[model samples]
Target: MMNICIKTVLLIFLSQIPVCFSYAEFKTDCSVPQSLNTKMILFSVDEEYSLYSPEVIGLIEFHFKEKSFINNVIQSQYVFPGNYDYQVIDKDLAIISIKEVVGNLVSKYQILLVCISDIQGYFIYSLEHGERMPNVHRDTGLYILR
Candidate 1:
């Protein structure tokens, strides 16, 4: 009876959460390497200042001979809106910061990259800072690391 009750409660809790799908395609022919030279890309879907919140996407890439590390962002309850930027603070770490203007409000969001090796060859993380943003950000917990 206890086992059945636990399973029923687990099913009920999970049922309330939304499902999200992710689609990724790799077009590169490069082979996986033990180490990489790292590069990052951060951008918003739009620059328009309106009542709406735009989507922010971050990409961290690791290349052959490039060494990189990662760190976690300081936990904040305040959500920031805007663009993203980064600086390599150490041989294996980089800090990414966000600042943008939406209407009269200047918003900010940030993340730190600390190191971990995944099977995919590099570490990637994404954060969607708004309630109405795409479900993919929330479902994936915005992090993909190799």
Candidate 2:
């Protein structure tokens, strides 16, 4: 009975070893590329492209040219001008810090993008406090490389 109990305990402890190391920590800072021309479309929560009728919230485009960063956000038929800074955490992962300026209002966002391939990726955006949109929450979206 003593040996059986010890073996059972050991089995339980070993079963948890993989769970502790399976999660990958998100990279914070690294050398990121300065050239970007990517367009991504944001979908409302609970929707994906496979639904055949995903509800799109907005479309965003990022451009880095001539040492300048240019960003465009289109929502509700209005285009907002913006700029961003980015850091590459890995060869296929990046964090984009953006500030969108609209007349007298400014909104901030931090985006985490994981590139699955050259033409497609997944992303999530966190909206900073004091945004122009009152009921807005954190949104996730997909990247369509341009």
**Among these predicted structures, which one has the highest lDDT?**
2
Per-model clash counts, in order, read 13, 0
Tens-digit lDDT track for model 2 on 28-76? 3332344454544342232443322233455756555432355555554
> Against the correct fold, how does model 1 do in TM-score?
0.28
Q: How accurate is candidate 1 locally (lDDT)?
A: 0.36
For model 1, residues 1-146, the per-residue Cα lDDT tens digits are: 45555556656667853233222222233332223335322221222333332332233222112332232222322333334455665444455554546566543444454433322223233333433444223111123333
Off by over 4 Å in 2: 1-34, 37-58, 64-75, 133-136
RMSD of each: 14.3, 8.0
Candidate 2 residue pairs in backbone clash = none
In order, what lDDT does every prediction score? 0.36, 0.57
**Superposition error at 120 for model 1 (Å):** 7.5
